[model samples]
Target: MFPLSLLFGFYFVQFSSAFFGTGGIFGHVLRYQKLCLCRCGVSGVTQFPDSFSNVRLLDGQSVSPHQFPWLASIKIDNRTIAGALISDKHVLTAASPLYGIPPNRVSVTLGLHDGCTRNPALSSSIETVILHSAYVSGYSYNDIALLRLRHVVPFSQFISPICMPDFRTLESDQVASTLSWKWAPNSVSCTPRVATLPILPVWTCLLNRNSDTITPNKGCLGPLGIKSIVCEDDVGAPVMSRQPYSSSFRLVGVVTTANCDHTSAPYYTKVAYHAAWIYEQIRDDCQCFSI
Candidate 1:
């Protein structure tokens, strides 16, 4: 087994640099997610501390600005969507924001927590917005997209990429974490809140959705109590999780639709289902393929 120091060092530097800088061990996303499959594997190692405990104490509890450095905020024309920083130059988000719209108008801001104060953070021109090819128009399946930044985003306490889960090992019972930002009442600024919720059983009413256009590319979260139902404004927000015995948090889902009243469960685009597609887009764009 590699020393803890070696693993931690790899967590921050190697994982980011090699994957983004073309140094070493950069493989497909799904395989990367399977790194923890071995009980005593190197991927079984973890880096960061848990943001909080397993309990879902409150719905909109205030989150410290420095937490969840991978948080991303995207703006297109007049609309705003939440995103997760998956890599140095890549941001993962919901494709619903891009449906029927051109990618040229999008811009992403990293490291910013409070928009009202115009607090310090990073911003970049979006080089390209790649939407999932299987995404259906006006529906929830495959509701994912990627934004390629013009340059790499430097890592900092307030900014870093979220870890990718080992898809091979994640169980349905995995705990899910999500952060929500609501526009201040009658104001333009947003206040960030954290919510912990349950993932619906693999077979749910939503899975039997009547729409022929809907695909099996999404997951359902909650039947959360009335006060905690995800609202319309939270669309595109990330639903994240930490693997057993690992401190790294990974993107699990992206909010597609939520009733906000807790009656109907909210739907999210399943990140695992698109792991292959994600690796392809990033690898091809980075031109990381070898001869």
Candidate 2:
């Protein structure tokens, strides 16, 4: 059984290169094996454990400090957007809000809880912004982007990358969650809130809405009564799924359109559908783990 599993892993690595354009078969395999062994064997680890213990089904609640180490705050000029750390030097986020913004004006902060008091030590200047080639301004389709940090982040109890899952792990109607940051009433600091949601089918997402707008690469979540699990602040947040019997969480989607009123379901760019693109872009630092 062990031998079979090992053989399968090798085949998966070789097979993925054809789809992801990783180049040179032997080099790709060696690079992937090294990445899996050295760089990100510890991805998705957390300092604060979240069992989603006794979580209410109706409302999202505040999470404890450092509960989500991969959460990233992308400050673009005066406003901020949520993002998820996927590697030492890369962050995954939505492309809509950043459509017209210049990459030079954007910066990212990790280990962030309160938005008002940003620790200078935890911030990094963005070196480049790579938007999905197919993404268009004012359009929801292909709304994904990657930000390369000028300086690599050192992993610690307070900071880490969320694991990027294999396509096999993505399934419909799975129990998932998202972490969002919203400003306090005083507008002095931001609070981190978490909510549990269920992934819905594309057909279900189009039931009450225009079917023409729902794309195959998009996925839906929520309609949780009147109050919603996601809001405007969650637009660029990561929809994550906790691995069974594991403390780690895998990024499943990137929020694109969230309706706070719960009148319609929220939508996200399906990470599984764009797995090859993501892997292709992050090839240099990519790491794969069993889903």
**Whose lDDT is greatest here?**
2
TM-score for all models, in order of appearance: 0.75, 0.80
Report the alpha-carbon TM-score of model 2 versus the true structure.
0.80
Q: lDDT by residue for model 2 over 132-186, one digit each (tens)?
A: 9999998899999999899877877678778776645654767677777752222
By summed lDDT, the worst window of 10 consecutive residues in model 1 runs over 34-43
Residue 168 displacement in candidate 1 (angstroms): 5.0
Q: Candidate 2 — which residues are off by over 4 angstroms?
A: 1-59, 119-121, 183-189, 224-227, 286-291
What C-alpha lDDT does candidate 1 achieve relative to the native structure?
0.65
The candidate that achieves the highest TM-score relative to the unseen native structure: 2
Q: Enumerate residue pairs that collide in model 1.
A: 33-166
Candidate 1 regions with alpha-carbon error over 4 angstroms? 1-59, 168-171, 183-189, 205-215, 224-228, 284-291
Residue 142 lDDT, candidate 1, scale 0-100 = 81
Shift in Å, residue 261, candidate 1: 4.5
**What lDDT tens digits, residue by residue, belong to model 1 across residues 13-83?**
43655455542354433333211111111111233336554435345456667577777888889877788
